[model samples]
Target chain A: MKYHILIAFFLLLTNLNKGFAGGGEGHGQAFDPAGTAIHHISDGNVYTILDGIGVTLPLPVIVYVPEKGWDMFSSGHFHPGHHEDGHHAYNGFVLHHGSIYRVTDPTFPAEGSVEVQGFEHELENNGGKDKDVYYVNFNGTKYRLDARSTLDGGVLGGGITSFYDFSITKNVVSMILVSLFLLWLFISAANAYKKNPNKAPKGIQNVIEPMVLFIRDEVAVPFIGKKYPIFLPFLLSVFFFILGLNLWGQIPFLGSVNVTGSLSVTMVLAVLVFIIVNVNGNKHYWGHIFWMPGVPGPIKILLAFVEVMGLFIKPLTLMLRLAGNISAGHIAILSFIGLIFIFGKSGESLGGSVVGSVVSVPLTMFMMAIEVIVAFVQAFVFTILTASFIGAATEEHHHDHEHEHGHGHA
Target chain B: MTGTLAALGAGLAVIGAGLGIGMVGGKAMEAIARQPEASGDIRSGMIIMAAFIEGAALIAILLSILMA
Candidate 1:
């Protein structure tokens, strides 16, 4: 049993290496550290099951162009020179590096041409903005095919620049799964309670009840005080959902679809907190933010501006922190795996790969173990802060405490 | 040269985070030793403060990535 476990772990590590390496040519024989690491963490148009084996699940590609009106097709249509389809293009729109773009050039060089590479340099020079390399906005401008699409090292002479993309990405699918899983788990737990009238909580109730209570008592009650019950459900759902997704990302096969690591997911979560805090804020909350009772008129105005800024900054920090940690963790693991290939290629010897694997694999495993603890801790921290923010907003300031403390000064 | 600079930036962010967390941990331990009864409250407060420091460091790291 122990040997089986060990072998399974080694296979998991090897498969991960292969999966990342297969994204580019040369299969698992070569590795591009930054490219591989980022590719693994970032969302993809096609769900890759086994890259080395050439088994991929293509997602639906939906695009809306002003001239073309609407172009909807399977992402498989974007595959380069397939035996079955011949060419992957719909209404002159080509999918490149997970983005759809129009191609006017009939004889564009294959993706990765020297001309395309030169265009990329020019594009970067023209705009210093942090462009999404995978999801480029089509603005009816002529792009050297290489600049237009990462896949086809060719050049796009000219194409439509503006198009609305509403395709269901891998992250979106993972989010749907997460939502359904939470609904199923919570509903069943609730049903158990309803069926049996509180006779020493059994099964799912036993597992979930304590966590619910912990959020209520440790997180909610201490921060929120009397109105703890009002926000308990929100706090519980946020905590469990974050925790579930974090843990889900650690599962061997499903490691790629880390929904929490995505910036959009974290931003949405932060937006919910921002909306709830502002919408549910009592008069006292607004009073403190806009006009402090004890402060002078001039100082009050300055403080109010700072307070208003804090409202936006608080949620921004929340979004960045979760996305950063989760994505960084995944990147770190992939980079460690990439180290093995780096050593192997550098010295042109098997000894380096062997030595590197011996060091990197164990370290990667240790990091993965830490990630499990991080999963729970991040969820806990997010929950507690949300509770605290809500608590601060709803809390009625007690002048009585100030009066009592003022006695000491006297 | 750019890679080296980015690595340095990432390293500096980690150092800042480590120092901040270390201070929080050290002080919290001392507080617990001095007043064991209030340790629970001290620990929770320490975690929140540490999280804020972590959030700042994460932003720094992310900005460095974009710059690189």
Candidate 2:
């Protein structure tokens, strides 16, 4: 009861103090889970919609329909408005100065077909302030992606969006590159294993074999006992798969998705581990959790409830921890950078940017290194836990030696 | 404030878990050096405990992330 009261008090206090937060709080920008005061949604940290060819023809309001292709795993784009119905409805892209523009029919442009109108500024292109309607091609059709200057010398929209766009982004391209590298690395490792099954292991084999051996002997051997070899591959696979994903998260642009941060993703991983452990566990393990070895029957009944619940708690925690830590790091780093924009609007903006950027540099770099280690460590920990949990279930509930020796009578 | 606090709490939670695992890993490595063959049993147990500790941190992080 006391604990509950304390929790309630804390929650109340937190709710009371939530006034300063920006509307976008906890959207996962890192440094400030709350929205930063400096950078509004108008800021360029996120992408905006385009009505036409150039990033011109200002669209003060562009509606975002959570189209079928929405990727929840990503931090995506959304306009800054709302209707009475609470839908993010906007007509195609509305121009500034009260002009509403509607989207045309489907067209995916080809290379080098659309004509480029000379020297006009699109909202996206901080290029130059001129009036131009430029055309660009994607597949074969010519499409306009430009921004226009209103009659009042104000800039319109500055985003160049495509109708049929799925696989294109500066960051995503880099992700592809990093993915290729991982593929190569794994393939090389696999080839090394295949090529040198015997004889003194060579370069890659030497480095890899020790880790493999360590997992086999340390993770599998004891927990799974005589059948350890059968599970070695699984342990190794989990370790490598997680490590690979974690490392992928760190790649310059491609290393996105706090894969370790996404709770759902982590939950799935943890659940899988849980299933594997229970399914493979020996009969004794279930007996221990449900019916115990030597406890009095009365006590055993109480223990069973605790034991079954404990199983769910263990994996749930595992999933939450990994996803939380990974995502938190990303949000923190982004928030640090975001402070510049928030403070940039004020007199203290200079000091704010300098301090924010400076402090964030060393701190983030240090954290990044720690993150790499964590990626591996967490993976190893999870694998081992699974091994142990399975081991516990399989191993005899009571010690054979203790039973034989009786009450300390050696 | 809520999100920031959540993130902060999560970070701190992971630190404790990290510290515990670090200690366990250090000792396990040390034990392995003194008795190489016993390394097998020592490592398995160490990993189990470390994972449990990590699970606590993981829970904190997941909750924080969800809140965010």
**Candidate with the greatest DockQ versus the true structure:** 1
Indicate the DockQ of the complex predicted as candidate 1.
0.54
Docking class of 2: acceptable
Instruction: State the displacement of the C-alpha of residue A163, model 1, in Å, after optimal TM-score superposition.
Output: 2.0
Q: Pick the candidate with the highest TM-score.
A: 1
Q: How much is the lDDT of residue A277 in candidate 1?
A: 89
**Candidate 1: residue A410 lDDT (0-100):** 3
TM-score of chain B of 2: 0.87
In Å, what is the interface RMSD of model 2?
13.1
B-chain TM-score, every candidate? Answer: 0.93, 0.87
Q: Compared with the true structure, what per-residue lDDT tens digits does model 2 show for residues A189-234?
A: 7798677766677776666778878788767886678877767777
Candidate 1's C-alpha runs over 4 A off are A1-16, A22-30, A50-54, A79-87, A91-123, A127-161, A346-351, A401-410, B1-10
Interface CA RMSD of each prediction in angstroms: 10.1, 13.1
TM-score attained by model 2: 0.56
Candidate 2, after superposition: displacement of residue B59 in Å?
4.3
